[model samples]
Target: MNDQHIVKSYDRDLEAIQATILKMGGLVEDAILLGSEALTARDIEAAERVRKGDKAIDALEEQINEEVARTIALRAPVSRDLRILLSVLRLAASLERIGDYAKNMAKRVTVLADTRGIEGADASLRRMAREVQGMLRDTLDAFVRRDAELAREVLARDESVDQMYNALFREILTFMLEDPRTITPAMHLHFIAKNLERMGDLVTNMAEQVIYFVTGEKPQEDRPKGDRTAYMGAP
Candidate 1:
């Protein structure tokens, strides 16, 4: 192939990669929304629909990874662009995990919705669900726009999500204690709350990937082990 033809082919591959990520992002956002709505409205039908589309998101992630591998083998992009491509794979993985989280929420909906004398979840659960979904929306937007500031904001939102999750834990436990009738639904809310907390973690992963794509530096993972104190001041 001539130089011009090779350039066009490479552009097409890159465009395809971008398109795949956006598709996965859109699906993930929708899963979260539908999962939350299903849980809140006690609509098992909606939950099942969300579950059915879950595989499509997984397929997209796999397809993108394959394309990225092929691009590396054929196009020989520069190191910086290569970092971005690999980061896209990481971001895709994160989004898949997010979809799994949503699926988990949906499954919990099925369980709780069918439980004996189980009603729907509470207002706090619904509010947190919406809040987490918004963060996912914003994080994906930052990725598309390549807005570092917005990405940082998304990272910051993880803390708030965590705080809300803790509160949900306490509040739900209290509700269950007050009335044993609330246990089934409360447990369902617990699963959804855990999913939202994990969603925050996944979005933070996406933000880290965004920074990596922009700077070619893989951000350090957050591991809290006595602040590395055992080795600190030892060397």
Candidate 2:
């Protein structure tokens, strides 16, 4: 009876943690959508809104921190449970960092829109944003669903975002090289692309973390090692 009760208690705690993670996931999705809108629409106000939304993400992190601390105080979490909770803490921090990158994208939006005038994103940029946003959405969904295969799928698709960013970078590079008139706006676009690339890298981190959560071990090294950019997703 005691064992059954303990198991039920642990299960309930896990569910609570999952719920908190999903709430944070929603915040990240909104940040991505709002950031993309700000850039595409050249809406400084939208950018500011994303910036404000980051505060809510911060608050969520704090809430999780407090809750986890309380859980620790009330119950003696075993090593495995400790790992799960700690992994979650790290994962949530990465997501929060991703939120900041989105805000950085928003700032770039304000700068570029002010310089270039708010018409809308070019066809190419819109396509890029759509691709990246899709990846972001899928990665978050995989986490919520605890689908390791889906997380790996997110990892495989990162090259798509990279290719899109490179292609767009080249396009803007030509703009910068051919005409000095394009320098300011082109730089703005360059930073935004860089930010998106960084954001994709962030998703990759979350995917790797998901893999750890499921397997309790790191994936085999197929790619080259010591790639700091691969792991440096957040503050």
Model 2 accuracy (lDDT, Cα): 0.74
lDDT of 2 at 57: 87
lDDT of 1 at 44: 93
Candidate 2 lDDT over 120-182, as tens digits, reads 335556665667667767766776677788888978877877777766666676666777788
Model 2 clash count equals 0
| Span of 10 residues, lowest total lDDT, candidate 2 | 226-235
TM-score of each: 0.86, 0.85
Off by over 4 Å in 1: 1-8, 115-121, 223-235
- Give the per-residue lDDT of model 1 (tens digit) for 189-229: 77778778778777877887786676556677762211122
C-alpha displacement of 153 in model 1, angstroms? 0.8
